[model samples]
Target: MHGFCMLNCFLSRPDEVTFTAQFDRPGNIGRVHIGKAEIEGYKSKVGSVITSRDFITNSKGGPTWRLKFEICTFPLKGKVRFAFSDSTADARDFDDAIITQQETVRATPEGHENMPENLNNLAIVLLQRFKRTGNLSDIDAAISAFKQAIHLTDEDGLFMPLYLNNLGNAFLARYDRTGDTNDIMASISAYRESKCFDHTSNPFYIQTAIFCYSRPATDYDGYPDDRLVAAQYWVGLSQQHDPSQVLAAYSTAISLVSQVASLSQTIQARYRSLLKVSRLSTSAATVALGLERIDLALEWLERGRGLVWNQLNDLRTPIQVMKPSGADYPPANITEELERVSKALDRAGASRELWLAPSAGTSFTDVRALPGFEGFLKPLIHADMIDHLPASGHVVIINVHEDRCDALALRRGVHELCRISLPDFSYTKAEGLRESLKLYLHASGARTRGDWNATRGMRREGGSGGVVKNILRDLWILVVKPILNPGLCGESKSLTLPEFAISSYIPTFQTLVDRVKKPRKVEPENAGIFMISQPGTPNQSPIPKPERNAAATVNRVINIMENYTCVHFACHANQNTSDALKSGFALYDGQLDLSSIIQKQLVGAELAFLSACQTSTGDESLAEEAVHLAAGMLAAGYRSVVATMWSIQDQYGPKVAEGFYASLIDSESEGLNADGASRALHYAIQNLRKSLGDSESSLVSWVPYVHFGV
Candidate 1:
């Protein structure tokens, strides 16, 4: 039986070396010989044999191996030669030859200094060997070799970052064994300093720096403050580069933040850590604001908040959107044969994570090169975007920070951005309120599974947590009422009521009950019923045929979304903590997830009323970041969104729905547009308060409703 053969050569001396010969052939006894070199124990039955420095092949099978080996001293001019019988053997022999050449040159100080490239190459191989065998000596050798190479290279040369990155990696490996913090610190410093060099043109070097900073020894189990500082540093370094580098940096920083959350022993601690890291959004916002670009600022805020999931879902966009355009096309198109190849290169260069597939192009150069893609993915400028809002409503942007909160109010007719001070509002206070709300709702039996019909019109405020009521009052007085201003809400004919569009997806309650009872789909009488009405023409509204699953809901919406001016979804919402972007509506058959809604990028989606539980709530760790369905819809191109901050009672769902649509339809009939959503919701909540006849219960029913987008 024919089997394969392999040869390995070890260069122990500048003038002489040794070779090891091995074969895959079992029990085949063969003596190996080279021109002037002969294997010791040449007659052994074993497949491997060692040979002296001078090597040549002599076997019964003519020209058995094609590998050509030549050992030269001094100027290293001549190449020793013998051809391998197979191409595979040829490639192996060629690689071995280079290794031998590098080892010989490294034998002398003069030779090492004269060829820095050779030294760098040898260092990479040694580091790889260290990885394979976990040999400390190999890593040490790699460090010494890379240091020499770095010293010999010019400061401005392209190879400098490569050399420095490799040296840093070698030190990190040694630090792991010796527990020497100094070694790790030195590695981080080297990596940070190397970024100053013009290595932006090289993808691998950029990735190397990111890897070094992200994997610093100080990051592992460090104090919360220390880890945060390290994460900040990573994000800072990431911002100094192009869009691709920024994405990579934030991706790693998000992981670090998640790790911080996981390391916490309590939910409160985790929330606090998340609050601190919320600086991620503020920092990105600061940069975007400096550019005088509100659209980019919004994108930065959204992307910075939901870093991990955003990056994962970012890549899932269309390849046409990912195609290289501007400056990248002339060079990139020639270099990368296919758009897929360009995408592959993009994934290779910018991704910090290996677990998920790359969906978005991170290369800033590539991003800017695409037509109309400047300022990072066709930003929706403040002017153009606000046009989609209702004339009767004001757009309030609440910026939450550590020191304070600022609410910026903009209306369709207003030219100036009005700043409102929220001196009493704070993140800590908001969190406390949230906790109180959760406790109150749980104690009140609001979220419990039951026939909500049986409990209709009943006052269920047993746990009457007064804190939530006070918080709502403060929100109305401080956040909402102040933003509405004195003259904005006047009965002005110029500011007509906003148009209305409504779509409700509700799996039959009986089906929901039966499924929960048996953990499977229930073929009940009315399984997948959707209720939709033509805005301003609700009298002629029709209830569509019952669809079977989530896909049907998605497809139905896709068919009707363009027909309606503003859209609303009244369904069950689930906020997926494990993967926030996958969080979505629980419909028949499946989930109408964030990914689907976002990917749609609806063109004329003016307003979205997500009358679902926790529509505005996201993972606490990403509190400052907009990782909720509302933000997802905004990013998906909706101008304004009405969502819930927390779950509301099932009974109130109908009241809120009926009140919102009636107001919206009336306003639109008079030409106000849909901007009345916020005001309508406010009035609806007020009406609910009147009906409840108590502050505490009303807060439970209405406080969860919040506005997003414009």
Candidate 2:
């Protein structure tokens, strides 16, 4: 109720983009320092200028690694500086940033003129700083502020991506700091942001996405869901924009080819290619055999498989290996199926040959095992390969909750059969499949605990203090996910998309209604007042309206069950007992006593549309009392109760109900729910929107119409 509405993004770009890089051979120059780590070169058969690390680092130190930038033949007209043009903060903050290097520091540039490509280097320089010191504040500030810099410099310029790449680094650093789930979400959310309608490749955007989504932490809320969602995003974007876009070219690098192959499989199958299914099974086999806790090993192994099957599906053999001094071992199992699964990938008219990365500092190679490796693909490894991915598989250290549990074994045997039928999948170690996925059998929601309070003269005779929001959220999530990301859904499990899931489209379409708003408040004196047991509240003032406050207009309240046609109720009614449920309704006053007037109302109504409480039996006897669940509501004139077994939020409940009503009413208007058409004029569901925006009454009085039916 107190949350801010997240502004829905409403741009209409046709889901893809084109990219063009600045250099003919864009790549990592690598550790090109000679003997004393000092490499010097001069112009030979080229129009280019030289920039030494000493000039950039301002070291004047022992040695420097230098780069030779080929000058623009037609005209080397302008300068490209790495330094950002705007920073409100002092230089000390930049100096204070953490940095790491194997040995010997690069000399720093003394002034702005002496530096080059600072916009592209800011992120890396800060990254180097963070890697060395582990302080997050500096990096966090940079991330928050860098967006301004990105907008300022990268506007259709020739070397914009040079700046965009550094900006991407800032975001990545921020993600690394918070592990704040939504932060990760926001970080990757803007990866493909458009600058101009031109052919420009933002590899940094894709690269950052791979990092934020792949090797995430456990405590981060909804990690797997976020990561999986992130994958679909980039994969779809890549396919839509440029399917063959690899981190680097692979035509000449066999290992790089394997890495790109892994990349291909992930996107082609829509993240389904199971590169290491056998290996995952074998590792889980170890766990089943009561072997050592292989969680960490499994995590590495699963990720390795995903990298092979989901991310890189081109090259076979190996990309890069981990070895200390002299080590001997069998090649990783997951890497074996890269070339095979990649066959299923859809050709987005892109190739997997152009991939690149730095040497990432590998001491030696084990190519002695390969002779038939004559593939035309190439590969490269970067120094910072989004560490912790470990070249290991995911399942090894996969969290329990992300995986489904044995709940599928209860009642419906689909999951039980699914495991055996799909032996390739693994078992889940989690408990409940999110309370949201959990349905309350007969009730729309579950009660918090065993006890419930009853208020006199109130519609909700039995209401509890149970919390059901999380469960409902889970339900909405499960129902909406498949529709939002069908490819991911198809790969993970066999759940079909629920197009009816309201929340899924609500963001994209603001018209996703929740509850049918109530009618305007008229003088209560103008409405018909009722009583029960022949003797209710002495003067018959109607216990302060069922909502909040003393002066409710009560103009457009729900009619008696016999009052309107069922078509008018819409989703406001619980799906139980014909959707005319009046469950979970209670006194906004929060008291716990049976309201006699409410009891009599239920006694007369044919359909017990209780979106209110959760007591099955009555005070006296289940069948004898007018408030009993099964018999009383049925005996009273009502056919059923769309009630809650637990208490739900008054905040979004009405909105959800409003949406349900809209859907229902929309369907009924077209003859879907024939019985819903019977509702009379004013109190009909069609008037909900009009009723909610009634500017006459204070907001509180109109806030308590959460229902339990239909």
Most lDDT-accurate candidate: 1
Candidate number with greatest TM-score: 1
RMSD of each: 17.9, 26.9
Summarize candidate 1's per-residue lDDT along 1-710 as a digit string, tens digits. 11112222221231333222453221121222221111111111121222322223333122323121211221121112111212123444334534654654544456334467666666765665566567887788788888888888888776788788888888888787788999999899888877777536676776666556666524443333445566566666666654445544554454455444431112223344466676775655555454454554444444344443333223333343434344454356433433443344223122222211212233434556656656543323454434444344454566665556656555666655456667777767676767876666666655542223355442444535475656566665555554554466454323211222121111111111111222212133322213432221123222222222233355676566654446666556677654455677655445677656655544445567786667877666556545577766655545457787666665676687778767766664333233556667767766886787545666556656776533
Model 2: residues >4 Å from true position, as ranges? 1-94, 98-116, 119-156, 161-194, 197-238, 241-432, 435-710
Candidate 1 worst ten-residue window by lDDT: 503-512
Q: Write the per-residue lDDT of candidate 2 for residues 246-273, one digit (tens) a residue.
A: 1111111112212222331222222222
| TM-score for predicted model 1 compared with the true structure | 0.45
lDDT scores in order? 0.50, 0.27
Q: How much is 428 displaced in model 2, in angstroms?
A: 16
